[model samples]
Target chain A: MLQIKDLKATIEGKEILKGISLEVKEGEIHAIMGPNGSGKSTLAAVLAGREFAKITHGSVKYMGKDLLEMSPEERSKEGIFLGFQYPIEIPGVSMVNFMKTAINEHRKHRGEDPISASDFLKIMREKKALVEIDSALTSRSVNEGFSGGEKKRNEIFQMAMLEPKLSILDETDSGLDIDALRVVANGVNKLKRDDSATIVITHYQRLLDYIVPDVVHVLFDGKIVKTAGKELAIELEEKGYDWIKKEVDSE
Target chain B: MENDQDKIISDATSGEYKYGFYTDIEIETIPKGLSEDVVRLISSKKNEPEWMLEYRLKAFRKWQKMKMPEWAHLKIPEINYQDIIFYAAPKQKPHLESLDEVDPELIETFNKLGIPLNEQKIFTGVAVDAVMDSVSVKTTFKETLADRGIIFCSFSEAVQEHPDLIKKYMGKVVPSTDNYFAALNSAVFSDGSFCYIPKGVRCPMELSTYFRINAANTGQFERTLIIADEESYVSYLEGCTAPQRDENQLHAAIVEIIAEKRAEVKYSTVQNWYPGDKNGVGGIYNFVTKRGICKGEYSKISWTQVETGSAITWKYPSCILKGDNSVGEFYSVAVTNNYQQADTGSKMIHIGKNTKSTIISKGISAGKSQNSYRGLVKVHKNASHARNFSQCDSLLLGDRCGAHTFPYIEVNNQTGIVEHEATTSKIGEDQIFYCNQRGISTENAIGLIVNGYAKEVFNKLPMEFAVEAQKLLEISLEGSVG
Candidate 1:
């Protein structure tokens, strides 16, 4: 469902992502493990069409269509969701209103009628239950004054609400307690379908234990140097990323 | 992003003023100039009593002796009073008892402004007094209001019918000698709305006035007076719009309100005068004096305004809490775009024990405009335990725009409490991108963020006016953000 080939990106004349590539099929979950400064967040941002990250030379194809050509809003309407590591705090914009606008925009792009008010409320209730988000929090301004755990859970709730075709979770497990992580992971797992895919980008293996991946790839120096089954996460947890770095250095 | 900014700027600068259309009709205007003769002619045109004519002459003499005040942070050219037409009115039509007697062209003008004058089209329970040029053309639901002993009509009509009330309350709140513009308005004021809510009576519906400047070369000087008698309550609204012109037009208006013992009065205004073009040629110079007095114990007064137009606006709607345990409030949202300039705020004076007041002002500046908020809060020694809270916030859209705040507070009473807070912020790029990432376009994001910022003051506006104010905020800031 997604393909990237020799992706090289830069910001302000400094190259962050060197030659990198990956491929993912539908119904599969891929975990990209990388150390700090390995360009994991940059990849996620680029995929979400962030304007500052200049794609020096590369191509990203999602369902055989050019992904880089779309604007950030268009990419969102196209069913690509990125759960931000640090969610933005939009003061005065109620969560319900924000979600409604996002959902209606997506529906408009698909040439469908807007979801009625009752149906929208029902969806919100269902999603809130799936993620264990407080109704009061959803009624308030979007992410304003929310605790760290609540922000992450809110992101997952948004994911369930939008029901995107491709979900990218960047450091979603960070700053989350064990129970919160489990709730977020369970929400993601419950929303997964055979026609969609997931990419979990993290530095640790704790989150992978809850949402098991079909394949594991080690991204080192902006390039994927190792690929294996989900067991690779356990190996990395035990041996650390030094082994992968040594192997890449020796190669 | 650069392209987006360019598109926004072009959009903001290119759109024509929507209320610029002129109506073709026979209009009678006095020769352009200001003199005792002109003032006397205006009084004679209205067929006023001798006392009324003498009042105008006294105000004209005061205006001639009073030099224009230049203390405001505004760059104004010398105004030639003799170069402006003092009075202009639509030719008199025979007195009629129904809306059918009104001129169809005038009705069409109101319709074009989205104000349906036909009683059948009015769904909301708002009685409107339509004032065009220098005279009030039609006042709807007069008999219905009269049934409640609620006096709602044009100032000219009130002068002839309720001469006692007019004589008693005309200059009680804001005297003719109060300021430069007030003196000028009192001298040659043509027409405006007058409302009187009797003792122990509540106004059944919202009372509104729509002021339009239709005749060319004639300045519109409107005077509004509202009196809420003992134990009474009334909410009054005023709105205005003007056709675009290449030559600047002056609009000097006075609004005086009196709230007696245990009475409450709420006044709201949405001023949309033509704000000239992008190059600052043509527009209305709006200099207005509005004040209210709480004369008896337990009285209250509140002023809420959304000012989005005028080439140069200088106004300060104030209140005097003279009664014990009285209350006052001022909530305003002023937006300036293109070459517009606005210097507006409120003043609260506490003379009574246990008096309370609150002020919230929001200013938005876009393009090359300038917006300022200047306010004053004073508590006298006799005002023991008086409390006041004031907050002023400014939002800037483009790099070329400006926002300023000047708050003055004086507490002579040791037991008085006064607090003031001010903040200035710009529409940041990160905020826009965050919304864009959520499937909202940049323009929509700006609108949402701006409306959010101004929500506090917008909440104070009446329901229908709140919606119009929100839409006006959006239109005024169009093409200002990227």
Candidate 2:
């Protein structure tokens, strides 16, 4: 469903993702795990078409189209969703209104009329139930004063609303307790379709226990050095990132 | 990606003014210049009484003696008052008994403005008084209003028909000697709306006036007076627009309201005068003084304004809470783009015990425009337990724009409680990207964020005005983001 060919990305003048290449097929869950500053987030940002990450070289193809050529909005409309590592807090913008606008934009892109207010409310209620998010949280400003776990759950709620073909979950498990992490993982698991794919980016293996991955890739020093099964996450968690750093530096 | 975002911001800030079309109808304009004779001529032309003529002469003399104050945070150029035409009116039949007697071209002009003057077709439940240049062309639902002892008509007609009411309420809140613009407006003020809700009567419909500057080089000075007697209630709104011109036209106007015991008055304005071109070569210089006074106990007055036009705007709609336990509110959303400058806010003067006031102002500045919020909250010595709450927020769309806040609070009564909060933020790239990642375009994202930011003030506006206010905000800064 997605292909990355020698994806070289940079910020300012420093290279982040150095010639990374990967491929994922339909209905498969891929886990990209790395320590801090290993270019995992940069890879996710590049896929999402974030502007600050300059594509110094290489190319990304999503659904057989040049992903880098599309705008962030167009990419989203074309079924690409990026669950931000740190969700932005937009004061005064209610979550309901924000979701309504987003849902309408996607509908408009598909040449459909905007969802009726009643239908929107129904969908919102169902999604909230699926994600176990309280109605109070959705009624307030978007992510404004939200707890860390609440923010992560809200991201999942948004993902459910958009129903994107490919979703890059950037540190979705970060700052989440066991219960909140279960809710988020359960949401992702429930929303998975046969034609959709998920990329879970994380630094720890705790989240992997809930949302199992088909393949695990350990990113180190701006390159993917290790590719293996889900056991690699447990191995990395037990052995720690220092061992991987030592191995990569020696290689 | 940064370049893309910047391009979107630039395009949004370059939004064109849609209401800049000039009507090609025959207009009769007095020669340009200002003098006592000109004021007298305006009065005689309106066929005012002797007392009214003396009032204009007095105001004209006061205006001549007063110099334009320069305390605002504005770069106002020296105005050549003598070079501006004091009066301009569309040529038409001197007396009109019905809509059929009105000129067709004039009716067409109002229709094009989305303001259908025909009462039967006005489905918005609003009674409109359309003012073109120096005279009122039509005032609908006058008979329906008159049946309920509610007097709604033109200012000139009120002066002629209900001179006693006009004499009692005119300039009672904002006196002619109030300021430079007030004196000038009192002197050469043309046609505007006059509404009086009798004691214990509630106006059945929304009273509105649409003012348009159709003639070149004409300074539109309109006077609006509204009086809600004891136990009465009324909601009044005014809208203004002008044709595009290369030379700046002046719009100095006054609005005064009086609320008696148990009376409630709500005044709203959607000021959309021409805001000049992208280069700021021409537009209107809107200097207006609007104020309301709570005269008796338990009276309430509120002001809601959406100012989105004019090259330079200097306005402060205020309320004087003089009655015990009276309430006052000022909600405003002022937007400026592409070299437009706006210095607007409100003033709340608490003179009675247990009085309360609230002020919420949202300023959005795009392109090279400058927007400032200057407000004052004063509690007199005897106004013990007077309370005031104010919030001022500014949103900037581009790097070239500016936002400023000047809040002054004075309390002589130790029991007065006053609180103020302010915040200024730029439309961050992250906010835009967050919206874009949700499939919303940059333009729509900015619109959503801006509308959300100004929702507090918009909530106070009447339903239809609130919708129009949102649309106006979208058009004013349609293309730009920071």
Candidate 3:
């Protein structure tokens, strides 16, 4: 469902993601673990079509289409959703209206009629319960004056609303308490399906316990130095990234 | 006619305006130039009554003796009145009897502006009277509005059909000699709307007038007067847009409102005229005089405006609190982008005991534009216990933009309490990045931040206009952020 070949990304003329190649089939969960500034979030931003990132040379194909050729909004409508590490606050723009617009914009891009307001509300209520997202958060402007936990949960809540095929969670658990992390991980676990895939980007191994990934990759510098099973996250947690760096250096 | 400051100011509005499109529409325009004979010709064309002609003559004489105001914080070249035409209407356009008689190009302009007048039911609770150039293309909801003892029609017809009402309130708030442009507007005003709400009636909808300037080198002089009688309430809205012109055009307008005892009047304006190109060579110079008077005890008047257009805007819609316990309020959100310059705010005069006034203004400057907020609040000795609260906030989108606030507060009453506060801030990169990290696009983020900053003023506009204004705020600052 996704293919990135030699993904070389730079921001402000400085190279960040250097020669990254990855492929994930449908129904698989892939986790990328790295220390701070290991280009973990940069990968997510590049995949989400952020304009500030410079794609010096690379080919990213989503569903066999040239992803780099599309705009951020176009990529979003094409079922590519990135759960922002820090959600935006849009004061005066209620969450309901924002979701409704996103939903309808995606629907319009598919040449479909807008969902009725009543029907839209029904899905929103149902998804709100599934994600454990507070009703108050849903009523307020998108993430305006929200807590860190609420912002992360709101991203998951929107993921449920849009139902994107490829969901990239960027540091969803960075600032979450254990309880909040459980709720966020639970939401992601519930959304996983046989036809959809999830790419979890995180620094800690704790979040991996809740949303167990089928594959774990270590991102050192700009490239993934090693790909392992779920046990690899535990190994790194016990030994720390410095131990792995020495082992990779010797190898 | 050129200097460093003038060049800097003119550089703000240099570029083609979004609405400046050339359409192949037939028009009936008079020759260029201004004179007493032209004023007489306009009055004769309207077939005005003898008294109105006399009034026009009086205003023309006042205009002749008055000198142009140069004190405003603007950089506009001298206007050669003789080089501009005074009157123009569409060819084959008689008194509009039906919507079909309206010019298709004018309707197209409104359609592009997202203000289609044919809609029967929509937000903003009312009908719209679309005035393109010098004529009203169509006035909607006439039957419904007329049923409520309301008189809504062109100023020309009002002079003929409701002369008694026109005579009673015309120039009652802003007299012909109030300012230089006002005298000019009164002298050769072509056409505008006049509305009257009788005693104890509340207007059921939001009344709107859209002015579209299409003809070249023809100044737009319009006169609008609305009166709410005793125990009545009414809200009136006006907006305008013009085609691009390399030669600067003049728009001098006068608006007066009167509220009787226990009556309320709310006036809102969303002025978006063609503000000359990025270099400010040919945009409209909006010199308007608008004032309202609360004549009876407990009367109230409120003015709200979103001025985002015009090359050099010089307007100060004001209020006179003459009635005991009367209230006055002014809320404004003015924006200057590119070569635009606006020195606008309002003045409030308190003369009656216990009169209260409130002023809230937000100014936003983007690109190389300059925006200023000039306001005055005065309380007379007789206005015991008079209270006023003023808050002004200015937002600078880019570092090159300029924002200035000039407030004059005068109090002669020992019991009056007055307070003023102002702030200036930039759309900091941190705030934007914080929003972007949450997946919201930069454009939507700017809109959200601006709406939050201008919420106090946006709340002053009617609900529908507020929504439209919010979207317009987003559209106006599209490239300003990125």
Highest-lDDT candidate: 2
Q: Residue by residue across A27-140, what tens digits does model 3's lDDT show?
A: 999999999998999999889876567899889999999999976777787888888887766655678877776787778878999899999999999999999988998888
TM-score of chain B of each: 0.98, 0.99, 0.94
DockQ of each: 0.61, 0.82, 0.13
Sequence-dependent TM-score of model 2: 0.99
The superposed Cα distance between candidate 2 and the true structure at residue B15, in angstroms, equals: 1.6
lDDT of 2: 0.93
**How do these models rank on lDDT, best leading?**
2, 1, 3
How does residue B88 of candidate 3 score in lDDT?
82
Could you give the CAPRI-style class of model 1?
A: medium
Off by over 4 Å in 3: B1-31, B44-58, B89-149, B157-167, B204-214, B276-281, B333-338, B360-369, B381-404, B411-481
Give the candidate order by descending DockQ.
2, 1, 3
What is each predicted model's overall lDDT from 0 to 1? Answer: 0.90, 0.93, 0.84
TM-score of each: 0.96, 0.99, 0.84
Whole-model lDDT for model 1 versus the true structure? 0.90
lDDT of 2 at A95: 97
For each candidate, report what fraction of the true interface contacts it reproduces: 0.54, 0.86, 0.14
Question: Which candidate has the top score in TM-score?
Answer: 2
lDDT of 2 by residue, B1-482 (tens): 56775687778977777788888998888889999989989998999999999888889899899999898988888889899999899888888998998889899999988899899899999999999999999999999999999999999999999999999889889988999999999999988989999999989999999999999989999999999999999999899999889999999999999999999999999999999888889999999999999989999999999999999999999999999999999999999998899999999999999999999999999888999999999999999999999999999887888999999999999999999999999888899988989998989999999999999988888899899989988998889885
Clashing pairs in 1: B8-B479
